[model samples]
Target: MASRSFAEEDFSCPVCCDIFINPVLLSCSHSFCSSCIQRVWRNKTLKECPVCRTTSSNDHPPVNLALRNLCESFQQERKPKSGPGVCSVHNETIKLFCLDDQQPVCVVCRDSRKHTNHRFCPVDEAVADNKEILKASLERLQEELRRSVNREQKLCKTAGDIKVHAQDTETQIKDEFKELRQFLDDEEAARITALREEEEKRSQRMKEKIEETSKQISSLTITIRDIEEQMKTEDVSFLQNVKATLQRFVFVSVLLNSNHHS
Candidate 1:
């Protein structure tokens, strides 16, 4: 009954009615499968709901992850009966373990053409490789994590120094502005001073602007340089060593790609 209720839920996709895998709700509040929605959205970004022809943008698709997970879990709980292969290539009761790959083999596919000269390793071998690959991946991840933490720490220190320098610069600017103000005020009060009041005010304000801008530039310069240095300092030798270590036990594809993934 619960499954039925979920299946009949409003806005359910027609293709996958048991809660949408990726729901595409239309302007009419009706929903459809994301693949179906994509087919429609391709025709028009401003697509109307199929049910009501109401307008809606195809930019967003709603996904009910919890419902999807529940549905999947329920489906998984129901075990299927194990049966023999229906295909001659994979005889009934025999699974197609890749002969070359040392996977499960069906007798029908034992044809010398497919299994010729191929050594079949048991499923256990594949599992062992998988565990080893996973372990290596974890170690690489841990190393990356350590490097990232170190990077953050270095960046923080650099930022702190920039901030301190900026504050000191601000203090100097304030001092200069104060002196300029006093000089301008004195000039205005002086009877015979040649300086115009407006001109002095303009000069003072412009100097303040210049000082503030300079401080900002200094901070930005420091931040940018620090980032460049960090990015440039990657240890090529270390990367080569890691790649070499991984190549000994796995396929070249896995070993080569590990560098990219790492």
Candidate 2:
């Protein structure tokens, strides 16, 4: 019964102001009872719809089989339920609905001065119209939600891409600096090795020169001792060794000069 109450309004036709009987679909997608529409056309000069000024292209519109089936289902659910089914304000049956204030009214309330100029519709018609508006709003809200989700997803993807690119750039920079540092280290090592090799060569040459000079000094000292000993032997011994001693002295002096120039 509750389902029927909620859905019963959707099956009502605007014409005849009641539930549809053999509902037909117009080109404008509005549904009306076939018999009701035919009667409306019977006395009309222009073949236009009563709700909208749209002209009817076909005299007999196609039957709204889907709507008919839905109406049938609603009717099956409309079994009587236990209720007083009367208005508390006027103690009358709640039949009419106030369109202006969106409230149900009894016949006495409908005739009241408060609703004198207000538009009125059957309870079912009002319910159906309100339901359609609600359905449209629901669809719009769902579309908006979908768009928001898509926007969020796009932003998330972009953020992820930015992070990835940043990491890649950071890695590349590290790799480039690492290569530069390695090159500098290799260059420094090569320079240090060259310096060491040069120093060793110079030191080795200096040592060899010092050893040669020491050998020359030792030989000169021995020659000087022999000459001195010969001098003490008298004029005959001195003459015999003098030539060899002078020759050795001359050779030592020449070697000393050569070492000083080098």
Best by TM-score: 2
Q: Where is model 1 more than 4 Å wrong at Cα?
A: 1-113, 182-262
Tell me the spans in candidate 2 whose CA falls farther than 4 Å from its real position: 1-88, 181-262
How big is the positional error of residue 76 in model 1, measured in Å on the Cα after superposition? 17
lDDT of 2 at 221: 54
- Provide the overall lDDT of each model, using Cα atoms, as 2-decimal numbers: 0.47, 0.63
Q: Give the TM-score of candidate 1.
A: 0.33
lDDT of 2: 0.63
In order, how many clashes per candidate? 7, 0
In the range 111-202, model 1's lDDT, one tens digit per residue, is 53446666554334543454455456445544544554555456556555555665565566556556676566564345223223433555
* Model 2 Cα shift for residue 253 (angstroms): 99
* TM-score, every prediction: 0.33, 0.35
State the displacement of the C-alpha of residue 181, model 2, in Å, after optimal TM-score superposition.
4.9
Q: How far out, in Å, is residue 207 in model 2?
A: 76
